[model samples]
Target: MTESQPHLLFSFGTLLDRQVQTALFGRTVATTPAALAGYATRPLAITDEAVIATSGQDVHLTLERRLGSTVEGAVLRLTDEELAAADAYEVADYARRQVLLTSGETAWAYLDANPLRSAARIVIVGDSIAYGRCDPQGGWTGHLAAAHIAANETQNRVFNLAVPGSTLADVSAQTPALLPPRHPDTLIVAAGINDSAVPLAAPGDGHDGLAHLTGHLDSLAATARRHNARLVVVGPVWLDETRTGDYEGLRFTTDRALALRTALRAWCADHHIDFLDLWEPLRDQPHLLVDGLHPDAAGHKELHRHLDALG
Candidate 1:
């Protein structure tokens, strides 16, 4: 297809709704009657609040490959921008794939990428905050694990491999655990604060530190890409100046933390990786920190809320 030509997208579900189309594309998309062969429709439950509100339904039809079945739908002509909008509208449960229609036309369709492995396996690695630290319940990762267990029985799995006082180098070394035979569906990295605190011992130390951090982050992203897993980098939270200062003869300041968070956010954006900013959310909440360095039980609960919303 030419760059100027609109892309053809086969819609077998919510995209058929005029309201959903308007909400996603700011206008109704032009569509023609079409049918997809070798696929059958199945009801996929929706948990995202925004998606449910937009489509006006808690469940939507998803395509599954079948031998002798055909799914009736419409072929939507969408611009590049509109196609990206459609992508953002879809939840992680669906992935777009190119397929041939009954009319001998090629179109993109959102399909159930893993029907059998529906449950998600998320692996987390970072520093103390991700390790749950001062929180008696292990922290936000712990809370997320419990919630998933409650909602999906024993199907879902969350692995927390955070280490206390770990840096980007430390987390990068842990990437091998996520490779091959048993790779997770998603990889969450909650580092940067520790690396930010490293004092510049020399004139060029600051520049070197940043370059090293970038290399480590790229390594982590490469590992995730090898397994086709989603990578999410959780930015560092602000520190309380009154209760936190130099540790083990090295200085730790809010300025450095903020700078590192900004860098991490920018890197994630450029690489198309997911980034969750915790700096602003926890900046004014001093009560959530027990030692000014780690989050308390309430703080961990707050973190859980934000991460849960990503689903």
Candidate 2:
């Protein structure tokens, strides 16, 4: 039999119940017994009583992080559209985050980003784009900081440590210093354009040693996990020039950003990390960029919207 192409979902609640499943989805689904490590279940009384039967009980099951504890559940295969429906069904009380299964694979599970309004910080790291090298100046990082603070999240801290002209290697090197002992809620990473300059990479088959690019990114993901931060990788955006600024003996073709973006999507998917495709979002929108390099004020505003939508 051919294997189904479906995203993995770890369900510990009513979404798994046979009756409830049929009521919402109009059919039953195949599910394998699964358990989530580092989590436990809590019963939350629904505000509206009409949801009792559909939710599988008077109180719905919610997940809580508890090291060494495992939440027994089922792993179901779902298509992209079904997953979106599931998301809509799971409204306000829950937020989805990647969960590592006992089988050494990763899947999406609803977990709060900022539970109970406690202190949460987000670290922004990247290149000139993130550093706000635009005509008007104030970048998306500043906009995001304001949004987070305005939401009144407890002890909200948005640290923008992106440096201009930095590559993936540079960000990886400085990341450790910028991280605090408490860890961060999110780590926004935007890079690759500068690294594509070729001369910045090691000696290899003319492609600036592209072999190690993925490895560098993987290492950075590990770093983010170590700090208990959710990794949000932003792919390279479109460039106006035919080629990147010359770096010694090398000048990367501007169109190559699209190829990097395509590879990045797969990379992020495999690593179960959040990725923002800046290239496509700003592809047809030329006015958003200043000199076809940095984002204008309106562009930064749009960037802020995309990151917010990432939630």
Candidate 3:
């Protein structure tokens, strides 16, 4: 047999976009609303409205039956090129794994893993989420390491370079210098929340919002490209309703965030960079926040759901 033209990807989040599905997976994808065992989902309050997951060390959600409750998704029939494209978007933060589907079938899905390779180092740049704070087991980074080992059945090294209370400028200032040494295969940059939270004065009085935002992004992107590695930019999550109007904590500067999101999306498109806009996915969920800034266990689970769908 020539081969059954590899056709399937179990997705869970924004990669579930119809347009993206068609573009990367050849024709329309075949999807089954599926649940990943051992994980729970939630919304994030910090950066681009995104979801997170909280899965314990040994707990797995038992699928007694194929629950019909579906989260919108499609499983695509993909080619190596298509798979490569999808990998560019996902593999940085996750490793592809074989998953048991609702129908008792199996499909290749991207499972979270430590972003590391003996030959290729992975450097994650973002905020507290990247730092794996609030999560005693080391947040997603720790989860990422476990997932990677489970999927690859091999060891891969990664560094959690996320600095708490640091802004995009701070990361930008630091990343380029380290690239020569780390030589990462993937550079994940999660910006916006902090930037929006701490806005710089209007640029010398003449720059527009778009210009200001893009200017900063341009610098980040240029640095990423110079490193010759894949750059994944995670937009900030939405602000909590309770803290929306207040600038004290976790509340986003709505105006600044919108500007940053638009500009970054455009930048991703123009530069062929991978962008995951998480804000819209978790906007409706008000209870995801554990505090004004971080997401609860439930909130983190949902974020992983979104990442799974990124394929």
lDDT of 2 by residue, 47-96 (tens): 65546646656677787544456889898788777787777667466767
Which regions of candidate 3 are displaced past 4 Å?
1-120, 153-155, 198-211, 244-251
List lDDT for all candidates, in order: 0.77, 0.71, 0.57
Which lDDT tens digits does candidate 1 get at residues 1-311? 65878889999888999999999999998889999765678899999999999999999988754445678989999999999999998998886755667887767778664422233567789989999999889998899878866766544667888898889998998767754544465678998787877563543454534557789999998777555456678898778867875566446678778788889989876765667777765678899888777889999898887766655
- Give the clashing pairs for model 1: 132-138
Better of 2 and 3 by lDDT: 2
TM-score of each: 0.65, 0.64, 0.54
Q: For residues 1-311, write the lDDT of model 3, one tens digit per residue.
A: 57547746767654566665555555555555654432222231222121112111122111111112333344656777777777765523455544445455555565443223211345787777667667776665666656544654433445668887767777777888877676554677875566665433432445333455566667776676565445677777665645555434334555667777877788777765567777765676778765545666666667756665554
Compare candidates 2 and 3 on TM-score and give the better one: 2
Report the Cα lDDT for residue 162, model 1: 88
Determine which window of 10 residues in candidate 2 has minimal summed lDDT. 111-120
lDDT of 1 at 119: 30
TM-score of 3: 0.54
